[model samples]
Target: MVENSNLLAEQRRALILDEVRRRGGVRVNELTRRLNVSDMTVRRDLDALARQGVVEKVHGGAVPVMEASTHEPGFEAKSGLELTAKEDIAREAARLVAPGSAIALSGGTTTFALAQHLVGVEGLTVVTNSVRVADVFENAARGGSAASPAATVVLTGGVRTPSDALVGPIADRAIRSLHFDLLFLGCHGLSVEAGLSTPNLAEAETNRTFVASARRVVAVADHTKWGTVGLSTFARLSEVDTLVTDSGLPAEAREELAEHLRSVLVAGAEGPATSG
Candidate 1:
């Protein structure tokens, strides 16, 4: 009886996920009605899906996780998600930067947040393929304090991706010619199996060049990125030196990542706590 009941529940959750993907989003009340399940049951299913990183929970409903192997969301669409977590992760990533080092930043909302924190760093040279990230520094340079030297910002020009990334041969050639002290990368998904992946093939190639040009690489992602897989894999987990993520990442996931990464920093209100 218990086995049959569990199987039935699994079937219901599968249907719920399908509905969310088909309709873009679904309300808890509607799910309960459609599934012929109680409100509490529907909520439980949503919670389970959320924990699996397959769905996002909204105010009174659930939505499909926007990231898929072939689907990439635009910068504006992604900027609104996990705002606090991104801020925390960015804060932690910024600490890895030194005053006089040259670094490369890939395009993503999390890296864009990291750019805001780096504007005031003295004697910094930033090479990026992200228009949004470059703009943050460009705007800051115009209004920066005279006491501090302005950071040099380099924008690698290429065809733009949905996430505002400049990718393709033009960007790749520029990155390959320059070497950076560090690379701060943001990805559509991170899993032990896929490592750092993106939905865009051109962006993946561009990111590969960025990784090759840097002495060290730090991946910046929120908890939601865990377990997600994209169409192309750029770097494996072992290729990255560190990972900076929010505290919301499950303990087991953190532990697994620690085994593969040199350092895993969990960002919090106080600061980032180091593991591995």
Candidate 2:
């Protein structure tokens, strides 16, 4: 009976998720009446669903969160949101690095920014799977007059994703043989229950291998990534050491992340690149 009750609860929760996704959102009162359940039961179900990355609970309702980001948001289109926030997060994230350390960068825009930030840093080695990132380091290495930063960049060889990321069995095997002091990365959705996930399964698989090889995982996302769940999971929230995002994150979202991650770093406004 107890097991059956648990199954029913899960079924109801799925129903709730479907309803919210279908309608975009639903009122608690309406839910209570439709499900013919008590208010407390509805709230409890919503809470559990929220923990699982199935829903984003509002004061009196719940909403679907996996909506797509508007554009491809090309590397050039990435200078949005609290620019200063990204800069601050970038600086703080950079502090996690030490001279002569070996790091791997995930193929995210924030990690790309980190590459630009490391241009003149004394001695560092990085491995990456991004054409843009490789270009950044290649350009910096080309001052034609200076010595290498004790840096040896390894680009994972694979077919590129729509976002210009290299992924597949080749990249996965490459990452399996590698390890890093740290990995700066990001995702489309991160949830307490769903873990770290992205819409692209191929990318998620590659990230799984990447995360498995890193000593520490640092997520560099903005406020919007929270409370969302994506198609395929890469890692659970507890797998992270730190999260750096813009200050615009809701207090509840910060608290929620703090529940699983070691710490949440909110980047202050430092103003973004304008004339770019």
Candidate 3:
């Protein structure tokens, strides 16, 4: 009986993720009626998800965590928001790339921007789940801009999320067999407490695999992500080897991050740049 109850709870939580994905938010009353569960049960489930950083509990319902802080905007939308900031962060990230190295690039606007700078890097192998990032490398190959031997790019196969990340079991399975010299990851939110997080649960799960596969982890995010807390925590602040962010990060926050992370690279002056 206990096992069956646990199964049911897991099933219900999966449904809740689906519902929230489809509707953007879910009212407790509606969930209670739809799941045929009591109001207390629905609240309990929401509470559980909240603890995992998957959803934000509202006054009477729950909203997707992406919507909580700047809404983890789409690729194009996010790309435009922090152009200069991302460029600076990307440039700094590119500096970390070594020739003849294997690396994983997780999907996010900042990482995508970093892909732009990596085009000329020689003998690099890139494993990524972002269609856009792969396209950049592919186009660069076709353009033939002197990346002698060219960069090898691997695209992960999986369900695409709102943030344009390919995730789920297929992506997870693909990453498990590989090891990387570095993993340049992007996150929707970052904090001293919650660590690195994203709004999508599957993306978060896949990101954890990226963390496990890489010898070093470098986070590329702008200052805007400082206080935002997403629905899922993929890694803690201490787990990251380096943080490449813009000057916009408050002094206090930078001091805090510097204390935990192995190194923190600040980009240009703290204004007019966008980040994920």
Q: Which candidate is the best by TM-score?
A: 1
Best by the lDDT measure: 1
The TM-score of predicted model 3 comes to: 0.72
Q: Each model's TM-score, in the order given?
A: 0.80, 0.70, 0.72
Q: Which residue segments of model 3 deviate by more than 4 Å?
A: 1-72, 145-147, 269-276
Per-residue lDDT of model 2, residues 218-251, tens digit only = 8888654555676788888788888877654544
Task: Kindly list the per-residue Cα lDDT of model 1 for residues 5-65, writing each as its tens digit.
Answer: 3334544565566567658899998876666668898899899778756799999998887
CA displacement after TM-score superposition, residue 193 of candidate 1 (Å): 0.3
* Candidate 1 global CA lDDT score: 0.87
Q: How displaced is residue 145 in candidate 2, in Å?
A: 4.3
Off by over 4 Å in 2: 1-82, 144-150, 270-276
> For model 3, where is the 10-residue window of minimal lDDT?
1-10
Q: Please provide, for model 3 over 163-273, each residue's C-alpha lDDT reduced to its tens digit, 9 standing for 90 to 100.
A: 788999999999999999999999998888899999888899999999999999999988667767888899998789989997645555677788888888887743233
All models, RMSD in angstroms: 7.4, 11.6, 14.0
Candidate 2 is scored at a TM of: 0.70
Q: Go through the candidates in order and give each one's C-alpha lDDT.
A: 0.87, 0.73, 0.82
The runs of at least 3 residues in candidate 1 whose Cα sits more than 4 Å from the true structure, single-residue gaps closed, are: 1-68
Report clashes for each candidate as comma-separated counts.
0, 3, 5
Error of 1 at 228 (Å): 0.4
